[model samples]
Target: MVSLRKVPGAHQHPNLPGKVKVEEDVNSKAVPVDQETMPTIIQTVKEDLGELKKFYNITLSPTRFQKVEHYLEKKLEELSNITFGKLNQAGQVDYALLNNYLKSSLQRLRSDKVKDDEVLKLVGSFAFIIIELFEARQRIQKLDFQEVAALFTRADNSARDLKQAISSGIFRGKIERTIAYRTAYKLEELSSVLRDWHNFYLGYEPLYSWWVSQPYATFQENLSILIACIQTDLVGFDDSVKDPIIGEPIGRDGILADLDFEKIAYSPEELIHIGEMEYQWCEVEAKKASCEMGYGSDWRKALEHVKNMYVGPGQQIYGIHDLAIEATNYVKDHDLVTVPEIAETWRMLMISPERQKANPFFLGGNTMQVSYPTDKMSHEDKLMSMRGNSIPLSRSTVFHELIPGHHLQFHMIKRHRPYRRIFDTPFWMEGWALYWEFILWDKGFPGTPENRIGMLFWRMHRCARIIFSIKFHLGEMTPQECIDFLVDKVGHERATATGEVRRSFNGDYSPLYQAGYMLGALQLYALRAEVLQSGQMTEKEFHDKVLHENEMPIEVLRALVRNFPIDPDFRPSWKFYEKN
Candidate 1:
């Protein structure tokens, strides 16, 4: 049966200063902010927005920028008329982000130097529709199939016309054309949601067929033809999307380039070798953990023992709240990074089963969702849900999902420039969490041999993820083969492995994301050797700088940290992993 889960507004991250609408009640506690001086600053921006207007001019040539300002300013005013007063701190941050978005459009237009007004206006429409779509969705209430489908269809067809313009114009080397493509990707996401709603409601939504006959029919036809053209012209059908780890297409050599591993770019075979090496190292550590647990030096036995402790007798014996508390103590005690005051107030909730098919593990952002099963399922699924999330296997990432991982990231990004959130990639989001595992393991955060095994298992899993995802993008592996590799090599439960692969291929994730965890960690680690290990900055100082810089590709980050000059023509030249 299709689960009746609907996509909510682009997840309103709990930690950020924002108003949220959730499927269930959330903490009513206001998101904390250091508003002492911010009110004055915000007021100043509100008064004239001189600072933003100055950037608008700087981004675009004085000659061409005036028209952009004239176009965008009118549209922003219309949106502000509708949703201005309702903004929470998070909402204010998004508003600032939208300002950056407008400025960026002009900057991109200037850089591309494309004088085609039609293309410029169409691309410009994407930025506005994106802002409006989020605002409209936030105003919606979850109810029946009829109301939900109606609400989203209106959102869809309205967006479809604006997006169809760039469907065929996405040529190679034109990076900004992806603005339209990514916007279309979001449209497809909504369409998929409606399709699922069509199935879940089972003819109850009267307009289901009605939509296909008129608006949706036209929208979808255009979408299909465009995607087919894009596939033939740009990225392939069964291949990854355009953006690689850094920010361009992941050509055969592009993955290494994106990861800053291009200076000595490894061949596919060598890349796979790195994964195998990590897997073997973890297996050896797992045996030691088994010995410490009195289970003998058999990895399978150690896994069995860990799995049993977590599942026990069909009920989850562990509480995620308790886990968060334990993680809080460990992170603070170690002083790896200062746990900010707002982090203590970050909340946790359970992920619904309908949502878990794509995310078998935990999902974290401003608010953290601890994964466990909630649906009516067979005995085997129940066991897989429990065993796959066994305490030892899950521990290394608990604090990672919360403290120094996403919640803190969400908090920092909002308070910092807020505009830089555009540069975020999975490399930074997922990589930082993975990097902490390295830091903890180095600092003896793993107390016993078993704890070490637990931590090392996650590291091995990240390495395997890079190998599988990159090969899939290179068109060398099938999804089934990816699943089998995870089950056989990473010791994932079969069902869990399937979910993992599904999430990777789904439109929600980019090609670089799965690789981002390990590859991104390596990027951060290499920089650490240059900075932290080299005594240019303490661990706290280095981490603080990264957090404040907000999330961007690591190559760009390296330049920022080193105070190297960059411009619109900035290319990935850091090559952090030259030797290995």
Candidate 2:
């Protein structure tokens, strides 16, 4: 889920990444965070993520003109005051984060050229509404269906009013049209969310008794009408359902460049050939590794042996925590990269059932969420989870998700130019973590042939992700075909393979995300070969510097790390992958 669970890649960093998070999240000076509100805060922010769904929704309309300018300014000034107020170092960081984020948001909102005002309005509204809803959900009597219906009724009326506003011809031009469209989109999205919650709560007798009464069209029905309006002739947007807000099909050259292969000078067809070759070569290596481990080239048996070591009698959680600690110690001993003091306090939590589908592996940054099955899972689910994540598999992931990976990235992002956290892509997020797998492989991290095979298994999976994602987006491969490719070519457990595909298309991930793991890592590997391998910088220096730079496209990252001449208006022209 590091990148794949993205939209849902499903992480809601309790600390998120940047300026606004600092202001809105850190609730108190003495306490730093209000315990009672923290869970609600985290969950609400995730729900607020809905505000980011439709890019057109960010555009504003003249009809929406309000006195919000003064309010935003006042709120920003108050946040700035918090930053200057006296507090402990931790509290100071939070205050500063909030102050900076609000300042940035305020500046953007004031820009009439950029409709960030509308963006903030909706985003802010979502933030407030989520908190209010969180509190309401807690107080509502479980059996009181009317109370739940009241929440829907409030949302429905907003929809009805907005529908009439658009139909009334208040929206005339592009800007006004965009504003109306976005408002409609948001209302529909929120309505859909409420409908899901209602269905979830309807199972209980208390709620069920109230549900049997009279009802009109559901919120979903109202949302459907609004959707038709915005998506159809009532109003239109540059973005379509196929073209997601953050995603655009970049075609072959773009894919190559993104993977740091702009200079490879190979045709897209050539790249496909190379990928197939790599896939085949890995198969040979996998069998060879199994043979060396006395499994007689049975790759499955070899992997199973390692898995059974961790899966214990009568169902235990395995040694995931111990393994992470061990990996942490290993990194500290090797000085692979700086694991700051902040990482010391980072906690490892089990993945929740609700999240496991999107994040079948793990999600980590400040906190490492292990993907092992909980006590609530069925035996079959537990078995598949165990087999898929066995010891060697987890070895790569633990290091990938914790130290030298997300946790370190998160720690550094907070310490560095926190504002830079705004620019996010899988290139840096998942790529950095994936790069370590390559780095560790080269340094002989997998001491035994069996270990090598396990590592190779993951390596193959990464490669396969690239090939399948490319093929799928190009209209050459279907999702089911992609799934078959993983299970067949990579030897992935069937259930686990399905989860990987699900993560790729989970409605929030970029089309290229599945491919990003290997491609991004390859780019970093190529960059290191250019500078670090040439003794321009030691491994420790290179890794540490990369982290402090925060996340961005690998091309831009290369420009920064290499000290390449970057004009004010910089563009990526570098091809770091020509060699490979």
**Measured by TM-score, how close is model 1 to the native structure?**
0.59
TM-score on alpha carbons, each prediction:
0.59, 0.60
Model 2, backbone clash pairs (residues 3+ apart or across chains), number: 8
- Candidate 2 per-residue lDDT, tens place, 1-580, comes to 0110123232132212111111122222333333323223223323333333221122232212222344335544444433233444323333333343344345434544244355335333232332233223333412234543554465556556655665565544544444445555555555555454455555554544464222324545655665665544444534434322211233554455433322233445655665676677777878888888889878877777766555653333346676677777877899878887757677767777667765677677777777777778889888777777777777778778887777778888888755446545676789898899888888888888867877888888888987887876565776668779988888777777877887786446865677668767878998888886678788889888788766656766676667654332234465555534
Task: Give the CA lDDT, 0 to 100, for residue 578 in model 1.
Answer: 45
Candidate 1 residue spans exceeding 4 A from truth: 1-277, 291-297, 311-318, 565-568, 578-580
The global C-alpha lDDT for each of the candidates, from Candidate 1 onward, is 0.58, 0.59
Tens digit per residue, CA lDDT, model 1, 15-43: 22233333221212222323323334333
- Global lDDT for candidate 1? 0.58
